[model samples]
Target: MREAFDHMYISCWEWSISVLEEVGATKPLYPPTMLRFTKRDTNSATPGPYSYPAMTLDECQLADFSEFETFDNYCYAMFTFYQLIQQTSGLSGEVNLEVRSPRFLETVASKDDIFLIEGMHCVKFKNDRFEEKVMAHWRREMPVRTFRRKDRA
Candidate 1:
């Protein structure tokens, strides 16, 4: 299951990078990022000692993640990250009002996971002009999984 989750997570990240590239906004958008792969045995009977290695993406190869998968999970991840960037940079109002190709609608229907589903809803609001009724519906819906960072300290 660890490997499957890792594959899913990495695939999601790759999808994000690909969408960013399609928009011709990779350099200005993707910050230096890292992925730390970890595995722990949930069964108490088996482990004597175990430590998982954290891997950092080399500067030159960070863009390679863009090829992880062809699924819509990538586009949703990009939208989520873009929102994060806007919030962090305090430039939410400065984002372009124009919608671009590979629009959220094009990719949303293909998503299989709840995280990506909620992500699509959020992206819809962020990218297009929606009715107040529609916006309220999505806002009321809860996401399946909230992103969390492992405690490293």
Candidate 2:
């Protein structure tokens, strides 16, 4: 489960970086020079090292979710995971995607975070077995799967 999550998170960065490169982003943007990881608190943690990609809006060079069909779904899953943690474990932090790119924001119609959930519904997983396994783990870990997204609309 953790492995799949790590792969998907890395894929998001790689995909976004490639798109930035195609559009002639500067040298520092081509190959990521710095990568940041947050260590989980051992006293109250899940199994394994469990570090996900962490970045701030200031660090974002591009917010391109174009052409990639699974991109929104990945974002939706990530947001959902954080929400689940907060609800199930009483964690405090919030997940907010404050997209700085006005051009990218223009492409998306919905102002609400529900757009991710809705967009995810439009795409299907290619690998059935992998999807099933992941979903099963999700079900076990997170009993409450659906929640209302904060409406910015």
Candidate 3:
């Protein structure tokens, strides 16, 4: 990280609270927090993208966000993740894309969002598996076995 910063310019400016204050940004945009996990959404009537991506953090982390320059920026960061869940969703009748590891999270948000944004080492998006009964229902013409979520245990 330092190498890249040093390479860009002769004078390597350090990012600090004072610098942020000078620019009217008192704190980091997104504080370190945990990515809220999702459970099965049973409501069929609801929209297609059932889950909303949220960040969960302990009291310490929440306090960190208090240093944010603007609440709008903070909230925007949250909504952006939810947007990604929608964008990366699988094809029709398919499952949502998985956030398997730290690397994949970078696609939607910045690297800082991975560590500071989600405060998690690994973020994964799980696909639902289709059950045998579901397949049998479509006896005339069944889609691929991986078309749906796995059976609920």
Computed on alpha carbons, the lDDT of every model, listed in order, comes to: 0.33, 0.34, 0.29
Write one digit per residue (lDDT tens) for candidate 1, span 51-113: 121222234234344443432333345445545444533543332223332344344423523
lDDT of 2 by residue, 44-121 (tens): 312221133233333434644333334333343544443343443333232232322333333442433433321321
Task: Itemize residue pairs with steric clashes in candidate 1.
Answer: 15-74
RMSD of each: 14.4, 14.9, 20.3
What TM-scores do the predictions have? 0.25, 0.22, 0.20
TM-score result, candidate 2:
0.22
Better of 1 and 3 by lDDT: 1
lDDT of 2: 0.34
TM-score of 3: 0.20
Candidate 3 C-alpha error for residue 130, in Å? 28
Error of 3 at 74 (Å): 3.7
lDDT of 3 at 108: 45
